[model samples]
Every structure is written in C-alpha cells, then in structure tokens.
Target chain A: MKNKKPELVTTAATLEEVERVFEAGADAVTLGHERYALRQPGHFELEQIKEAQQIARKHGGRVYAVMNALMHHDEVGELAGYLEQLAPHVDAVVFGDPSVLMTARQVAPELPLHWNTETTSTNYRTVNFWAGKGASRAILARELSLEAVLEVKRNTRIEIQVQVHGMTCIFHSKRELVSNYVRHQGKDPEQEIRAAQRRMFLKEDNREDQRYPIFEDRHGTHIMSAEDICMLEHLSSFITGGIDALKIEGILKPLEYIQTVVSIYRKAIDRLAENPHADIDSGWLDELKSIQDPARPLGTGFYFKQQIY
Target chain B: MLTQTVQSTIASPTKRKKPELLAPAGNLEKLKFAVLYGADAVYIGGQKFGLRSKAGNFTYEDMKEGVAFAHAHGAKVFVAANIIAHNEDFEGMEEYFRTLYDIGIDAVIIADPAIVEVCKQAAPHLEIHLSTQASTTNWQAVSFWANEGISRVVLAREVSMEEIRQIKKYTDVEIEAFIHGAMCISYSGRCVLSNHMTNRDANRGGCAQSCRWKYDLFEEAEEEDTETPQIGKTELPMFSEEDDSFTMSSKDLCMIEHIPEMIEAGVDSLKIEGRMKTVHYVATVVNTYRKVIDAYCEDPEGFVFKPEWMDEILKAANRPVTTAFYYGSPTEQDQIFGVPPKMAKYDFAGLVLDYDEKTGIATIEQRNHFAVGSEVEFFGPKRDNFIQKVEELWDEEGNSLTEANRAMQKVKMRVTQPVKPYDIMRKEKK
Candidate 1:
C-alpha cells in the first residue's frame, strides 16, 4: 500500500499573506472576511477573500473560509446571506457552531463544510455526528493527544484536520472580560477596552509567572495557550496516525512568521513524501528553533500529554 | 418589541397550553419534592453516564421508584444520560439505556450522537432530548437534531429571546431553555478548562469548576537577558496591586420576570438547573416558579410581574441574579466579579420524615440550625404552607432539646398543623 502524506493547511489574514503562504507551499489556506470569523484583527473584506481565492487557485492551493464564530440568533439571517456570498469564492467553510454548519448546508449546499467545534469535539462520536450531518472535514480538538487522534482516525473515515502549529486556545467566552475589567475600573469600555490591540496576558494567582494571551474581538474573548504549539518533530507521527491535514493556527501572525513556519512544514512534508519511512530530520528542528519567537515559548502541547483539569 | 406588544394585547391568558415547568432533582427524595412543588417534569442523573457526578444520583432501584412516583403524580421523569461518551465510556451504556427504558424513563437527555444511536438500538421506544451540552443554538442545528428523531433541544445559554422566537418559527423541535441556574462562562457547556486545569473532564461527568477560581494578571518579559543568553527570561508582574476577584464566575440566571417573554416566544419548557442542589433549594425555586407561571397563565392581560416574586426568588438564590443573555449580550453589570459573601434570608430548616397526628408532633431531619421558638413554615405536595412556632423539640433518644443544629439530625418537633413526609420546613427571615 502506498503511504499517503497529510496536506499542509495554513492560515492567512490578507491576500499578500495568502500569496506568501502559497509560495511557501501550503496546500490549502484558511481565511475569512471581517465580522464573519472568530479571528481578531481580521481585515479581509469580501473583495479581499475573492482576491485571496484567486491567488490560491492560481498557485494550485485551496481557500477555506472561516465561519467559526459562535453565533447569536440575530446573526443567523445575516450569516446565511454571508455564506451565500462567500460560498463560490472558497472550497469549504470552516465552522465551530452547529448552527453555522447547518446554515451553510442550507444556503450553500454545494459548498463543502469543515466542522471545528472549538475543542468541544473531544471524541470521535462528535466528529461522526457532524460527518453524518454533511461535514466534509472535522478539525480534531486541541486537547486530543496523538493516541486519541489515532483512535479517531481508526474509527472514522472522514478527513481529519489537526492544529500542528501556533497558539492553542484554552479558554473561549462570549462575555468580553477585558472590556468588563475596564468598565469595572471606572474607565469608558469603548476607549479602554481595546484588549486585542494591547495584546494582554492573564495569569492565575497560584501560577503567578505563567500568562496566556487574552484576545478579544466582536465575537468574544479567547485566552490562548501560554506557549505556541510546534509539532514539526511529530510530522511523521501525524502522517502515520492517518491525519488528513496538518493545520497551522496563526492567521493574523506576522508575515515573516507565517512564511517561516509554512516553509518549515512544507519542507517537512516534502521530505516525508520523498521518504515515508525515514525519521524526521533533526536539522528541521534546529531550523524551527532558530526562528522561534523570543517572546513566545514553544511546546508540543497536549499532543504529547493530554491536558486534564 | 413585537413579542412584548403581542403579549400585552392578550387580554387574558392565551388558551394555548402553558409550557411545562422542568426542575432538576439530584436524588430520589428531591425528585418527589420537584414534582410535588408543581414541576411538570423532573430531570435526574443516574449513578453513571450522566453529568453532575457529585450529585447524589439515583441508583437503578431508586430510579424505578422515582419514575413510578413521578408518573403517579402525572409528571414526567427524564434520566440524564448526557455525558459526551468516548469509546470506553460506551462499554456499558447500551445496557444502561435498556435499564432506563425498562424502568419507564420519560426521555433520555443525551449529547453525543453515538449515545443516541446506542439508545436507539437498545431502547428504541424511549424519547431523546438533546442536552444543552450539544450546544444547539440555531434553527438549522435544531432541525438537524429534529430530523434525527430528537423530540426536544435544550437550547444553548448563548441563545437569546429573539433567536428562540426565530427557532420556534423555523423548527418543530421543542425548545427547553434554562430559566434559572448557575451560568457557564463558556459557550453552552462545552468547556475544557476544568479538564485542562484539574484533570476532571467537564464533557464527561466530572467538572472541577476551575472557571470559578481567581486568577492574577502577568505579562511576558519583552526583553531577553543578553548577558545570560541561554537562561530563560522570567515573566513580569503586570499589576503591582493585589486583587481578589473571580473573573470567570458568572452570576446565576433568574428569568422569573421574563416568563411572559418566554411564553410569548413560544418556548416549550422552562428548566431550572441545579441538580446537585438540596431538596430545600428545589422546593423553594420550583414552588416560586410554579406560582409565577400560574399567575401568568391565569391572566396574560392582567398579568403584572410582581416585585414580591423577585423577593421570593432571593430566598433560594446563593448568588446575585442576572437575566443572562436573554435581553442581549450580558454587560459588566451582569457579572459578579468580586467575591461578595451572600446569605439567603431564609434558611432551610428541616424535612419532615414522619408526623404523628395524635401527638401533634413531626419527626424532622434537621438541615440547618433552628430553635424551639423559631417560627417555621411547613410546605408540601398540593398543600398550602402554614407557619407555626416550634414550641417543643425532642431528639431521637426522647431527650428534650431547646435547639436542633446538626445537619441530618433526627428531631421531633411539636407542630400546630399536619405535616406529611417530604414536607420542607424553613426558618422565616427575621
């Protein structure tokens, strides 16, 4: 039997980044227009998404539009309309909300759907549920270990996507905690509640030195992992585990970071394609270490040891 | 606004069947109290494969009795088989579902599609209600479940009144919403913080409630030490001041005032959410909602929300109340940040174990401190509450006592009125 290597999935915030990522050899690039996604500092407009789609297609890459925000009832009507507009421009719409997934299935029946239940799809049964409901791909939760991922792969035949790089979100909430904090301090929330701009971190009193970045946007607050996930070393394991796609999580990251990270994964995947049975090159690890953000630490995340609370 | 206008124009309670009042029961005793206190349906967790593992969940034998008790009272009993089952968790689930069905459980509240499939194979006759843990927010999601033969969807807490109206308009699936309960900081109940922090899976039955823990702020050090290039840089303290505030603990939701809005929106059921709560909590909250719902149904046009209902609700609340995301997204005011110690004015006094009509005395299992002269109100199934002074008290040993303080202590107290088993006694607010 021929060994099938997983595709490299990367995220981009703009058409420029999309071009850079495609140049770096990403098979598919995930992007979404502003106000329609959970990402902060999201700048892509409908025109930008269309442009990015055109660039990806030109480079023989695919564009997956993110519709992963937790929707309120009022947004449903607008969302159906937005999905209808964005459908033709993208290959598949990635979603965390069931409502959004079902809405996409209704509004754009031809468009494929990627189910990312935002860490809630902890087991294979949830993936199977979405698969039965018409999800073409299922993004495994960040909390899943490699063993769990293997278990899921063995059970379900649906294409599986795993976050192999960048920040892992630990906490997500609808309440704007940072805005509430500013208001509690007697400051105007409008002026002082620019949490995404500030790039603030939160630490528990007990675990004083550890801090996780708190990202706030129109959708809600997202507290990301203290350390960025680097699974460059585990590329072979994921491929062997039958993962369909290895996703790089940071879309709004610096273009240099995106290019470097995507290129590293691209090289890794290419090397694996050449020699499927060969061990991951130590030089790749060294190269990843050289470009590691001094401010942000790197860890293997829950892929090695599952986070339990 | 349209719902408000329509509700206001209804000169009398609409002839439509009033939505069922659903209550949570942690144990068999609480289940009886929930049905007795005017709950049309009661949801409980079994010994396994359910959320609220800390709750004194029913054994199979207890469930059999509880189900019979509920059915006898014309109320439905739902077994919460709502855990997000992994492959290992499904080992004994099929047998569990068969047992639940054989015992005549009205429905199985489930979240995982695999478990729903298991139930279908094991107990095809049983109805299925999707748990809020499934996070059904939109009509399409509800439609998806409805197509799968799910009779009801406990809408996610993130859903709003406007959305409920829209969902009802679009889908035939019955909507059951949390009308009163502790709120989760995460969307729906799909949180992993508890599991990540404490190793207790929140999706499975164990939740350590890590969100309620206090957190301090810290910033990552921007500059690296050039002299010690190999050494890791330490994170810097973001704030010099110390503050003890719970940034994640949300206020308990209270929707007593919004009963009209819910009814007008065509919600199918109003669910009260504390399964691990005491029987007194169940009785007080269930009774208060029962009165409010009845009042609204009696005269929709003449239905004026009484301020006294809020006062009645406070007697059962442990935390400050917020309307949650019902009106809109909750503001800073909606959350309780600082840990303000709260005490309900009325304390759960005791539960009547038995009453001797000849002696005019009741055998009570004391829950809180109560003295001989303390004025207590006794309430029970289909009976109006009556106040009486505890003139005499006797321990199980027949020794006279002036007061009862120890929890679960059996004490005989003189009563002026007849009290039945399961009747709850409470000390009045001074």
Candidate 2:
C-alpha cells in the first residue's frame, strides 16, 4: 500500500510503544509537545527532544519532529541547529516557510525535510518546487480529496503521506485555537479564565470561537483546519498506492487512543496486504465511531471521492 | 517647520520615513545580495524570533553580521519577532528584541497583542512591521493594527490592488505587499495543516506546510475501485452540494505584470516571497522584476511587457507564474497539475571555454544529449533569444558525430556572432 504512514507522528506512542505500533502496522510518529507552549521557554526543550529521538531509535519509526508554530525567524536556524545535533537520529524535521526550508537545507543537507502543511503546499508545482529545495515529503492538506492527492503525487517523486486519523487544525491551521486565552488574560485574568482564554492565534482563549466571528471569506471562523481522517474502508489503497505512511494525528489522547487507532490500522493493513483491494467490515467502522475522534467531525477526508458523509 | 514636523498629522511616526523594497533575506549571502541588488531594507531572523523560522534563517553571528553589513551599505535591517507569542515564547525572544532594538535594528514585524505590548515596554524605540499573518484584508483590520502604533502593514497577499488602494486611502501606516513568489493556501495566512498532523499552527509561522503533500484519491461515495464520476468537476453544485464550498487547493500569487496598478494603489514597498530560495533564485527574480518595474516607470501607457520577458522569467526559475487573485478569483486554468518542472533550458552551450574573435565559433561544453539535427533556443543578455538549430555537431578531436553524451566533453559550434563571457544558452520545451 502507498500507506507507509507519511512520517508517523504521535504523543501516545513512546519509543518502544511506537516500535510496536509500527510493527503492529503503524508507519511514522510525529513527535509534538503535548504540553504544547507549556513546555519551556521554547516550543520544546532541546534535551527533551533529544530524549525523544533516543527513544524513537528503538521503533525505527521515522521521527518527524514537530516544530510548526514558531513565529521567530531566528528559531528556524536555532531549531535546525538543534536538529543538527540529532543528525539522522531524527528522520525528518517538518517545517513550514520557504525561508525555514532554506535554513534546514544549509544546516542538515542529509536529513530529510518534510514541508509542513502550514506552508500551504497545495499543488503539483509547489510539490516539485519544494522537492527541488530538498523536501522529500509533504503533509497533504486535509481539504484535498483523494484525486487531488493523486494529482500531487504525479507531479513529483517526493513521497506522499496522508492523515488517516487525528485531530485536524480547527481553523485550517491558521487562527490560534486559543486566542481568547491571550486577550482576556493578556496581563491578567483568573486561572480558569486563563484556561478559557486559550486561542489558536493569541495563545489566549478565543471568545470569537464561541460566537464564531465571521471568517474573511464571509464564512464562519468556527476554526476548521485539522480534522480526523480515518479511511478504515480504504485501507487497501493506503498500501498498494505507494503511500509511505498512514498518519494518526493526536498523541495527547490516552494510550487507549493509541492502542485503538494503531491496532485498527494494523488489522486493516494486514487485511489489505492479504487481499490487495477489499472493503472494511462495517462493524469495525462502527467500533471506530465509538472512539474519541469526535474532534475530527467524522470525515473520510480528501483521499476519497470526498462525499460529505 | 522642524517643530511641526514632529507634530504633523501626516508624520505621526516619531520615526517617519518612506518605506523601501523590504526583501526577505533567507541567508547570509542573500542578505548581502538583496541589499546590494536594490533592497532598501532586509528582514531576517536568528534562531527563534521570526515568522519564517524555516527559511535558511540566519544564525546569531549571521544575523549580527548581516545587520552590520546592511547598515554599512546604507540599508536598514528588521528583525522578525512576528510570530504570535505565548507566555513561554515571550521569554524566548524578549531579550533578543531588547538587544536588537538597542543595537539599531530598523524594525520588528509583530502580530500578537501580547508581543506588541511586551515590545512597547521592552523595546519602545523599535519600529514594528505588522506581518501578513495578521490577515489584514480590510482597512478595519489595518485600522486596528495602525491603532497599535504599527508603522507598516504587510497586507495579506489575497487582497486585490483596488482593495489595497482603499486601505492606503484609510490607513496612515505604510503598506507592503508580496509582489512575487509562493503564496499560502489559506485565507490571510491562517492555516493549521501542521498542527493537525503535528501540533503546529501555520499562522504563528510554525506551519508544517501540509498543503504540499501528494495524496491518492479513492471515491468515497463508492466501495469499489471504480472512478467516481464527479471527481474532476470544478463547478460547485451550489445548493445541491455540501455546506462547504469544497475548494481543492490554493493558487500561487504573482503581481509582477501588475506593478503599475500596485504602485498606483499605494503600496509603499514591494515584497518578494522566497526566503528559502537559492541566490540564483533571488538574483534572477529580483533582476527580472527590477527590469520590469523600470520598464513600466519609463513609459506607463505605451509600454507593455513582452511575452519574451515572461518566457525568460520562466527560465530564471518559477512555478508557472500566474496572476493569482489579482485579476479575479483564481481557477483551474492557473493550476499546474502534472507539468514536468520547467528548468534552465538550452543546456550548457559552450562556456567562455574559448572566445576567439578571429573565428565566430565559441567552443562550448555540450550540455544536453543532443544529436546533430536538433533545434535549440539560445539565450544571451539584453533581450537575446533566437532559434538556432544545430546543423552539425563534431567532437573535440574534430570528428563529426551524431551525438555527444560523454561528460565534460567539448564540442565546436558556430553562432551568428561572437558570444561574451557571461552569455548563456538554452533550448525551448516543446
């Protein structure tokens, strides 16, 4: 299957757990800070990242170090310089921004660069263009349907990874999910208020999210970017189509989340391997419906004919 | 007059000045290149405090030296502390801002109110360039940022020149627009493709760039491998379709041909998008735009950009240049689905291997796998292009042959006239 897991990422799977998940049919683990901005002075502490890399060694899972929401240009090189310490230990460092890609290329020529979807790579030229800049892979936009993905694949030799399951960017990766958190608490608001204030942009809570301010497109700003993409039905295409990986988004969930998602894809992967193209059992889809992917809003995502099921 | 200058309405900025070509310098070399090439100001980042954290972002020493170099070259430097700052991120770049401001960095692009308030207190004298991440598609948003003492606004790339004219009419803040390069797929630069797959928000400039990934399509409406009939249809079925517009992708932006409209609309500074591009990329693009702009300035009405300029521009390096959003709403015609990457064509013609004025033939290293009878387009400086078919191809030893595939091998070819040291040769794609 083309589904190798587009550079697997997860907070749920540890080095060993991740190895088993991949062995059990997981593809890659995108390492992100579950604590989020709560980590330290930076998006992540270098030592913590180093430890994650060390742990990732056991699984042989390609470690895609997630450092996507940084605003400072300085951090590009700093994080890249930091990644240089990891060397090939970290399989790829996913990042957005043309400028950041340039820095990563100069710093770690051998280490693969995966273009972050935040960089908004939506077409064949972008794929080939970034591929020319040393990008080996991309996290396809969730908004893209299966046909679009195939079109993107045809444009370049770069590997295509799809999100089969996970928490999607609520504002399509733009607005800070926690902006309200910043505004009300900018200098001061109570702890609960502070918690309530977290916004996707402001790092504060977004009151706009509740009332859902109108989006610029004259649409609603009810943040919608990252959504869960579970193709339990099309697991066979995930393999035979040459997808390097099938990613599961949320690592913040309980280990049960990990166990359930990894185990399901594993079974599906096996089934597909045995019978190159087959339908998934209805019961399995029902069981998945019971899981904690409510945040994903239940869509098969873009890789399908993309019906609004 | 001196006293009124400080108090004048037109001069609200305590540090008032006309905005210049604010270019994104992705690396040390590009920093110098941009400054020398014609940029009045350059924006950069060290290890942490800028939006394009992924551009060949400068190192501490690289940034420091770049600042110094630009200052030395009569240019200004702006540090991007533009990312939306969190409580933790505040501490990460707090000291850097103070130090940079104290050391004479021209400005700092900012968005988050928290960051702005912090900078106001921390680096009071530091000028602020509001980033495009703020999504200032309207004058209200511009007015909002302007209220915060923002001196310049990098208006969202999606806004049209007419809208920009309206914004310039309303706001006193200097406006900057991205005149060239790759554009983001989301509205106003707010994307979360990264955080969805990896907890990275694109707006804070930490985008995982999910828009670029290749995907495989299975028609979800059906169970089998059969082609879903409506798969390639571009028209939305309106009321019959789902609630969402079902957009497939975002378009690339380029306003090069529309320089006059942008200038007339009141953009103070023109911006180019590649921060991670190579020097070759910067030089070719910057030089091309520079020529185009000069051409327009020379004759606004009578002058027209020749198709040859656009063709030569294609050779410089590009993603099929399109007039994204500027002309009207972008559609599939602008989209490049399966086009083979256009490259520096005409292969390596004879280098300055030997320029013998006595004989018009310039000995060149044969570039492509060429046979004796292939027609190739030759390119040189100053509107130089011609269809020159290779009537004959002979080896270095003077043996006439059908083709030459050997590496570093030399071949003799005749030209209409003698070629110069910096002249280049290429072939057009059929």
Candidate 3:
C-alpha cells in the first residue's frame, strides 16, 4: 500500500485565517484558549473553537486544541470542565503537562491526545511510552537533527509530528523576566512591551551579530530564534520516513505569511508524496524569502548541525 | 531504606515521616563528606548518561564504594541519569541501569520516559524518581507519573507552597523539592539557548549556562524600515547600558528560614542542587539543614527558626538568595544582573586527618594557605564550631614551618581542642 501523506498542519488566530489556511491547502489548524495554551497566534474562546472545527469540517481539514500549558494547581481545577467543553469540538488535544491526560480521562475519555513536551520529546522509547498512555501522536522537539528524527520514526509505531518551518522558541520562563527588567529600569512597562510583536530583541554583551526576539505574556517570557526554520528543501525525508504530520509554527507570523508558507509546504508534500526522489523547486525558496521577515533569516535549524556545547 | 518518622499535616492525621535531606555529591570524596555531614541521602552522577559532565562524575567502582559508605552510615545513594536522550544516547543505558542496580543504589533519578522504561525492564528492583528536568508542576502530572509506577516526582522549582500542599493532599506518591541551590531561569528542560547560541545541548549535560551570559536589550523601531536592519549594527538605543548589560540569571534558592513550612507541606525529600559545587559547599549546606531539620522534627510545637543557619549558608553562596516560587512568583529582586564572582567570606584552610589527644597535635591536609598565627574556626558534623588561633605548624617530615601554603600538603598543628577526622577548619578572609 502507498504510504499515506502526512497531514499539513499550521496555527490560526481567527476563523477567517482558519478558512484561508485550509483554502491555502493546509490539512489542519491548531488554536486554543489563552489560559490553556502557551504560545499561539491568538486564543479562541469555546464558541470560536466550535466554529473553527465547523470550518475545518466544511473544508475536510482538522482542528487541534492547544492544551499545552505546564499547568499550575490553580489551573488544575478548571481543566476538567474545559476539556469537557472542548471534547466534541476538536480532533485532538496537544499537551505538554501530563495533568491534561489525567483530567481528560475523567471528563472526556474519547478525546485524542498528542504529546508535545516541547524539548524533552527527544527519543523513540519516550514516544512509545506516551503512545502506551493512549496519545494518538507525538510532536518531536525541533532540536533533533535529521538523523535522530529518522531514527525515532523508524523505531516508534505511533504517529509523529515535526515542525518544517517558522520561528522556534528557544527559551520559556514562567516568571516575567522582561517585565521585571522593565520595572528594574524604574520605568512602567508600556503595554506594547508585553505584546509578541517582533519589536524586542536581545543582543549578547560582546557578540553583536545575533538578535533574539523576546516577549512576555500570561505564560511568561519567551525568547524565539534569530533565524526562522525553513525546511522546504528537506520535505522528502519526512514524507518517505512515514511521519504523520508536518507542522508550520505560525505563532507570531502574519496571516498572509502563514498562508503562503502553508501553501509552499502543502505543494512540496504533495510533490514528494508522488515522487519520493524529487529535485528542489527553486521557486518555492524564493517565494518563502519574499514573504519572510528580512531581519530573521531562514536556516535549516538543527537538521544538519549538532547543537552541542 | 533510609526513612525518617517525623510529621506532616497534609499527608495524614498520624505522625507523618519527616522529609529526607538530599545533598549533591560530584565525586566520592564529596559523597563521604555529605554523608558525614548528615545528609539522609546523596545524589551523584556517573561518568555516563547524566548531566554535569564537567564535574568529577563517579565511576562504577566509585559508585560501589560510595553506595557502601552511604548505606553503612544510614544514608541512601541515588544516581542521576536525567539526560534527555536522543536515539544514539540510548546505546548503553540498559546495561548502565543494570550495573547501577547491581551496585545496590537506592534509586535512579531519570527525566526521560524511555530510560525509565529501560530501567523498569532491565533492573526491575531499582526505584525511579522523576528528575526536576521533567518539570512536573501539578498534582495531576504527579498522578500520571504515579500511575506509570514512578515512586517519587521532583516538583518543578516553579511550584508554590500552596500548590505543593494541594498536590500532597491529592497524591500519595512521594514528592521531592529543591530547597537550596541555583535555579534555571527557564522551566527546566524547556530551554535551548545554549544549543542555539553555543552549539551546546543544555538538556543533555552540555549546558554552557547561556542564561547567565549578559545581553543588551533594544526596542525595535516600529514601522517597516525599507532598510532591513543589519543584525546587531543598528542604531537601536541600548537599554541595559547603565548596568553594563542585561542578564536573566535568577538568584539562588534558599529555604533555611522555612524548614517548618516545607516539613508541613509533606515533601518527602528536601533536595539541595549544585552537583558541580565544592566540598565546602556540600558540607556547609548539608550541616546547616541537618541541624534545622533535626531541631524541627524533635520539637515541632516549639521549633524556632535560627539566624545562624542562614549565616552559615552565606559563607558559600555565590549569589543572593530568594525563596523562589515558594511564597509566589519571583520578582525583580529574585534576578541577578552583571555577574559577580562567587561570594568569598571564608577560605577553607584544611581538613583534619588525625589528632593525637595526649600530644595535642592535629594532623591536617592543607587546602588553602594558612599561616602559623592565623585564626581559624574548627567545625564538625556533631560538634559545635570553635575558634582557635594557629600557634605553630610543622611539615609531615617534622620540619618546622611558618605556614602551610602548598595544596594538599600534610601539616601538623598544635590544636587546643580535640578535633576528629573529616573536621573542617576555615579562616576568615583577610
């Protein structure tokens, strides 16, 4: 039997964006409430979530609820009810903290779980461990090299997801390090400081060539990569490797940019699905560059280079 | 096997077990010192499959010796194999787990679920304690791991006292928490700054501590400049100039004043971090907490916090201390900017090797410089610290010496008070 094509997944902030990305050839869109999700383009309320699911169904696409927060005790009491309300509306729930699993089992036993512990989802045994706990899929950490990713795929029977494009978060602190720094400067932080607009960057003391984008929200401060990950040229390894999904991180990207990127990946996956050994499409790279932020260059992140000290 | 019967208000109405004092041992010597200093259990890393690769990690022989020593002293030894493993990294882990089990270690602290599975299958008797690197924060996560047969879960440093109390109320699994040590600015195992900037994987024992590195913050100009800004050469105003640079390093966690609160929270283990710290640090921190925990468990109703314990820890602290996330969220005060060298209030003078009570001559091994007339403090695990002035010194060959300056040099001194082996002598900074 021919291998099934991996689902092309991306994030959406609005119902219109959900409709647009699905129209642009994405197979699924992920969104959730501000309280339950970590970094997302925007949070959707319960009503909006149902509407997005409806839109996905109309377009033959899927909806994934981002229940990926490392939950606190105060947040635990609200999870059961949230998952109960969220059960019938989405296809799967992507989570990092296992508390979601415990709560979901009690309130929504039928809801599927996709484990994404951010950076700790490195090896295949752990992937299978989550699969034993009934996770339908596992999102691999972006820090894995291509060789390691293929190895994990070869070893695990569960469906797997990999980020093929866009900004990758390098650091996340539950404390408001940025706001605390603002207060330490003796100035009240302007409301814009907390916004995820790509306006704030960190430069190392002596090394001046790199800029790391940083911002603060309810999940606390997040520092993103100086270069966005663009895996358009390497779509064949994942396609032939029998991976289940290819995710384009659309957390801070504009809707138009996300649509274009999703279209590029969608076409690439289709081409590779038809012909596993295919030449690079020069036009696709050029199209991504035209829409990507000039300040943030695109690189094949951790796919080739070993990130070691 | 090392258990203590103390008190816990949240776990049960009966007299609950007191929390175990867990200390870090980078090597065999540190392990012995930690056990002698009253650690109920000590965690160490082997030369493989662990973080803190820079430290003097134990070999299999060292682990066997260390485990024997700890068990003989009524303490337990735990090996940390907490690296977030990749595929190739799993090569020898099963055999490593079997070897650790054969050595009769109390448990293995692991973060990777795959490795936990390997340990369960290869060495079925070995207990598994989840590493803080897993960042387990809430009770449900604890329950999830418990269902997976994890005996203990180390609560993330981000967890609050109230959260811990609630977690204990709901879950019967043992909970471990960090009470003293440096803290990661990000959620443990949730950061890759080192990998991005320096090509070092922080989750896999190659942490360069990139978070402590200083950075310059800038506000990007609004409105797309037709000119794509050059990476760092732009004319953005540097907001961190006044302090030289911006740093996100957090203050060290210290709970010397909150012993009763921690005990009442039903924490099974109170762990001290810093596997890369010095022997002096292990001794000082372990000795201080040992005294406090003993005092509180002995007289729960009348226990009073001691200022001396805080003073003792300050001698070895590198940065200021904060009760991180215990009371609530940490603020500006909890962060450290413009890195300062490790605080040096006292210098380790020597270690007592042997003492002749009749002759009043103490044999010592010099760690740092100390003169004949230098005043020093002698302290032991079971004895009160006493101050004495060095009147004279002699080399091992019986040659009279004015000072012991050579590192690890054997010196004989006329000590007024009787001192035992493993006793520490430190001098105030001149």
- The CAPRI classification for model 1 reads as acceptable
* Error of model 2, residue A258, in angstroms: 26
* Model 2 regions more than 4 Å off: A1-309, B1-19, B215-251, B338-430
Stretch of 10 with least lDDT, candidate 3 chain A: A190-199
Highest lDDT, which number?
3
Q: Give the TM-score of candidate 2.
A: 0.48
| lDDT of each residue in B155-207, candidate 3, tens digit only | 99999999999999999999999999999999999999989888899999999
Local accuracy of candidate 3 as per-residue lDDT tens digits, A170-272 = 9999998877877777766666364424567888876687778888888888998888999899888888888889999887677888888998888888888
**Against the true structure, what is each candidate's TM-score?**
0.91, 0.48, 0.95
TM-score of chain A of 1: 0.93
What does chain B score (TM) in every candidate? 0.87, 0.69, 0.93
Candidate 2 local lDDT, A1-309, one digit each (tens): 323433334443454454555565455656644321111112334455666565556555555666444322223235546656655566777755443455566677887877764324445555664676678887666655666666667656988776777545444322221222222123222332233321221111211111111111112123333235677777666566666556776533445556667777767776676676666777777867776433224557555442210
How well is each residue in B121-230 modelled by candidate 1, as lDDT tens digits? 89999999999888777887788789888999999898889889999999988999999989787775556776566657787777877777877555344345654332
Residue B177, candidate 2: alpha-carbon lDDT: 88
Give one clash count per candidate, in the order shown: 9, 115, 4
| Candidate 3 segments whose C-alpha is farther than 4 A from its true place | A1-3, A190-198, B1-17, B224-235, B238-240, B339-342
* Candidate 2 DockQ, CA atoms: 0.04
Write candidate 2's Cα lDDT for B155-253 as tens digits.
Answer: 766666667777787668889888877777555555554544444555556676554442211111212433432122221111122221122233355
Better of 2 and 3 by DockQ: 3
What TM-score would you give candidate 3 relative to the actual structure?
0.95
